[model samples]
Target: MILIDADACPVKTEITEVAIRRNIQAIFVAGSYLRVADHPLIRFFAAGDAFDAADDAIAEVARPGTVTITADILLAQRVIEKGGAALDPRGREFTPASIGDVVATRDLMHELRPGLEGQTGGQGGGPKPYAKADRANFKNALDRVLTRIARG
Candidate 1:
């Protein structure tokens, strides 16, 4: 199963296509209703309008051999701790050896965000714009993970 923290995810269509082609079940968990395409292999779960609701729901459902897609470092950590694989939208895979450093860096960034905002006159910078290359990378990463799981 592929568990997705779907809010703000840019690879939904790509995921659906790949999962369907591979005959894998994909569950997209979101904070509210999202208009997903109709597909037998794809399921959507709305976790309501609460902070981390979708992440929490995904954590509950993900298990060993499950693949989780999320950009939240904390959520990826949780998924990794649960014996599942986690991949960021930008194709970064979160693993036990790397998650700690990632979390610490994320925490440091969060702590410095206010200072950064002040420096930038309250106009904070956002992530780089998503590009076709990112989509291709994500697809490749997903395929590799799925293939490894299938082999095992």
Candidate 2:
């Protein structure tokens, strides 16, 4: 199963395509309804309008054999601790070995946000624009991880 944190997800189409090709169950979870492809292997789950609702829903279902796609570092940490694989939309996989450092860095940046905001007029630079290469990398990473899960 592939669980997607889909509110701001940029690779929904790519994920659906891969899910279809691989005959895998891919569930897109969001805070509200989002049109999804009409396929048996693909599903849409509306987690309602609560803070972190979608993330909580995804975490509840995460375990071994499940690959969760998310960019939220905290969510990734939760998934990993539950024995599920977590991959960022940019194709970076979060493992137990690396999540601690990743969480620390994220926390540091968060703690620095107030000071940085004062310096930059309260505007922080978000992620870079998603590119063709990112899409390709995500596809490859998803495939590789799925294959490994299937083999085991």
Candidate 3:
């Protein structure tokens, strides 16, 4: 199963296209974003109105090798530690070995965010143009996840 953390998610359309091409199931899970479409292959779940509830739900039900598309490093850590694949749409891969330091830096930055209220560094390195190269990379990553799950 391909699980998406849909709150502030980029690449939904890209993921949908890939899922269609691969003939697999893709579920977009959200907490309160109620504007998602209703599609046969692409399922949408509104877990709750609370923050991060969708993340918790996805983490709870995800098996040993599910693919979770999320930008949150914290959630990625949980899923990856459970033997799953956590992918950022921008192509960052999270794992147990690196999650600790990453999370610490992320949290520290969050704590010190108030100091950068006027810093013009505005959220760089987001999902790029979903180019052919990105599609190829994403396809390979999805294939790796599927292969690992199949082996288990």
lDDT values of the candidates?
Answer: 0.90, 0.93, 0.76
Clashing pairs in 3: none
Q: Pick the candidate with the highest lDDT.
A: 2
Better of 2 and 3 by lDDT: 2
**Candidate 3 similarity to native, TM-score:** 0.75
- Candidate 2 minimal-lDDT segment of 10 residues: 114-123
lDDT of 2 by residue, 3-41 (tens): 999998999999999999999999999999999999999
Error of 1 at 49 (Å): 1.3
**For model 1, what is the alpha-carbon lDDT of residue 52?**
85
Q: Candidate 3, residue 18: CA error in Å?
A: 1.6
* Candidate 2 Cα errors over 4 Å, as ranges: 115-122
After TM-score superposition, what is the CA distance of residue 38 in candidate 3 from its true location, in Å? Answer: 5.5
Runs in model 1 deviating more than 4 A are 115-123
Clashing pairs in 1: none
